[model samples]
Target: MRLATFVAFLAISTTASPVEKRADAFGIDISSHQGSNIKWSTLKSHGISFAYVKATEGRNYVNPYFKNHYDGAKKAGLLHGPFHFARPSASSGSAQASYFISHGGSWSADGHTLPGALDLEGGCAGLTKSAMVSWIKSFSSQYHSSEKRYPVLYITTNWWKSCTGNSAAFGSSHPLWLASWASSMGPLPAGWRSAAIWQYSKETGSTPGDQDRVSGGSAALKKLALGH
Candidate 1:
């Protein structure tokens, strides 16, 4: 009974409350690990406004369910896009960016399609801090050359500091999709003043995957999708 009550509370808290409904957007980031049976329409009804689907990693290894998640999110009326897992030690950033774009990371002007995101976390993959920063710049530049917009950068404060030696090169250009996972967003990486998206919890409630909070409401969400 306590577990059930706790679940009820979590559902109420994670799904947009009245105040959040008026001011912010809630979303999820998912991959094949979440399985292919997601009920996206139900999540939208529960106030999910967007979704990020894992698309590719390295120069290969596309997520098998990328299309399903992208199509399902679109059908459910959620702004949706793909994210690429960074592998700086395995391949050139430009090559990996090409692989990601050719596979499913391409962006369009469609209102519901969001620009691709770069999921850069974990260890530095043995690259020097300068190399890591250069790798990221190469990836961002390549993605922009192809898609006409820089990919959103998904990172955590500690990882950013440790891996890239707290590089601020991309902060001015790339959107920060910060993974803080706390009651509130803590200190950001150097250079960024705020995050465009915050992955607040790895847990899901009335949603299929990790929970996220958008900084601005629907207008900002639309602007992000529009690449403004």
Candidate 2:
């Protein structure tokens, strides 16, 4: 992630401060470090209707705040989704996805929780670009087999180009949460015509983490939240 790109991300996003007004259904994502005192009501009062909390990383690492954040977000009346950071080299995607599910990514028919997500950023866990694509496929396959719904894929252009060769295999089936700070989504990896959620900001003191916008507004957001 280039500094310039990250800066643009902060600018494009409306920011997490409740003072900023946004018409779309924008949300925030956080990990254990956000602390347990996050005022979820304050976010909801500001128009944040949903959130994605980090659950697990690789396979063994679990977010210390996942349970709290998840339950707290729900208590605040905000839709919640749990995300897992992918570490293809640490373990097979199948194993990692299963582990994530076992920990906190489990899907339910409840409309408040979205399907699990795979955050496939950062350096490839030591695999070739082609091998990285294979890793995602394996992970997605395992996740879908168990949940009956495709877990959302969150990624950036540089990582995708360098790791997966920008494979289009999962585009049509999996909804994408594209990470780009540019004014445009730029060129999406092959297959995906558009992104479902655009992570427009990475620097925002108001939210304590990254913030994003759901492409289809609140209605579409409801569908994703319901895992439809």
Candidate 3:
């Protein structure tokens, strides 16, 4: 009787959990680490709709292959944009934001261009939770001032909670590119009820880099790019 009850409980728990649902749009993110040679047209043929290319890190270190990736994606008919890897400990947020924008992280109203993203991982760079949140705010503010829209934040829930105390400060304004390399999305951070893009896998294959799914599909993705 006890074994039967345990099995039944396991079944119920499994059924109650939300699985990762497929989205209409799939994309990939790339950096200098991914090398310069990428088959963008092949990726597009394989159903890739968008891409995020790394542009800068900290207040220096621009990705040398940014143009190669960006232009390649555009030429292949995939919407694309640049992203910045944050180095909160190395410099002020505004300084880094300015550096990023000057390098390649700027956004335009072009339909094929997506808004820049901030890669906000790496254990807060040794900042306190409050300091981290303030740094993020400063970066977001600077980006918004320059681009007229807040940058998408590429972060994991665990990192957000640990680094910023899961602050809801940007949830209402910024779109989240959630990095959860798991079968389940698990719990979201404090502010966001849903992710704009969910990075579900780190495995590379036909897509080029990490795999990501746009939450609301192509329509939502276009809206993100158009700032609508």
Candidate 4:
């Protein structure tokens, strides 16, 4: 009877296991798929410091909510930036880079513009790992030359291993935004020494979106936003 009671008590316990929350800063990443229900001020009130809004993807697809989210973040006093989802084999790197920059990838020294990110996981469509790396390199290079800053790489260990050869080749120049559901940051990418941000969960606050923790607090993150 005691054993059964113990199990029941454990199941009903409101307290939870420990989770990693030692973040310099916390924020979310959103796209048109998440809709426009986000109230930036309310989120700010809840201590949401920044956000990354989906801009362009592939060669031509733009996030329909890009402008509103960007504006909303500003209106709500949240620092924000744009992200482009990669379709490695669908288009040439420079071509896609052009599309993304033209849409919203351009960064200004303004306080709200965090470094843009290249979301790299995708259906490769037969693109070889070597070719895919080259593609991403070309895109990031072009973005750097044009905007004077390299975009962050958002990726996972498994995807990086299979699709990117798990090499830390880009780590020196491009910071990483690693995604993991574990209670901690877990292992970073093979080449990257540390992550710029860790996407720790897919749910947070009153909004349904990916949650993240910036490595260096709000100051470092804000510097990236200002293109410093």
Best by lDDT: 1
Query: Candidate 3's error at 83, in angstroms?
Result: 0.5
| lDDT of candidates 1 onward, in order | 0.86, 0.81, 0.83, 0.78
Ranking of predictions according to lDDT: 1, 3, 2, 4
Tens digits of per-residue lDDT for model 1, 58-121 = 9869999999989999999999989999889899999999999999999999888889999998
TM-score of each: 0.92, 0.87, 0.87, 0.85
| Clashing pairs in model 3, backbone N/Cα/C closer than 3 A | none
lDDT of 2 by residue, 1-228 (tens): 232343344444446543444446778888876677777776676567889999999888999988999998999999889999988878899999999999999888778788899998887768987888888889989999998889999999788878877787888899899998766788888888888888876754443367788865678788886765
Error of 1 at 158 (Å): 0.6
Number of clashes recorded per candidate: 0, 0, 0, 3
Reference-based lDDT, residue 43, model 2: 69
Q: How accurate is candidate 2 locally (lDDT)?
A: 0.81
Candidate 1: worst 10 consecutive residues by lDDT?
A: 1-10
Give the runs in model 1 whose Cα sits over 4 Å from its true position: 1-11, 14-16, 204-208
In candidate 2, clashing pairs total 0
Per-residue lDDT for 178 in model 2?
A: 92
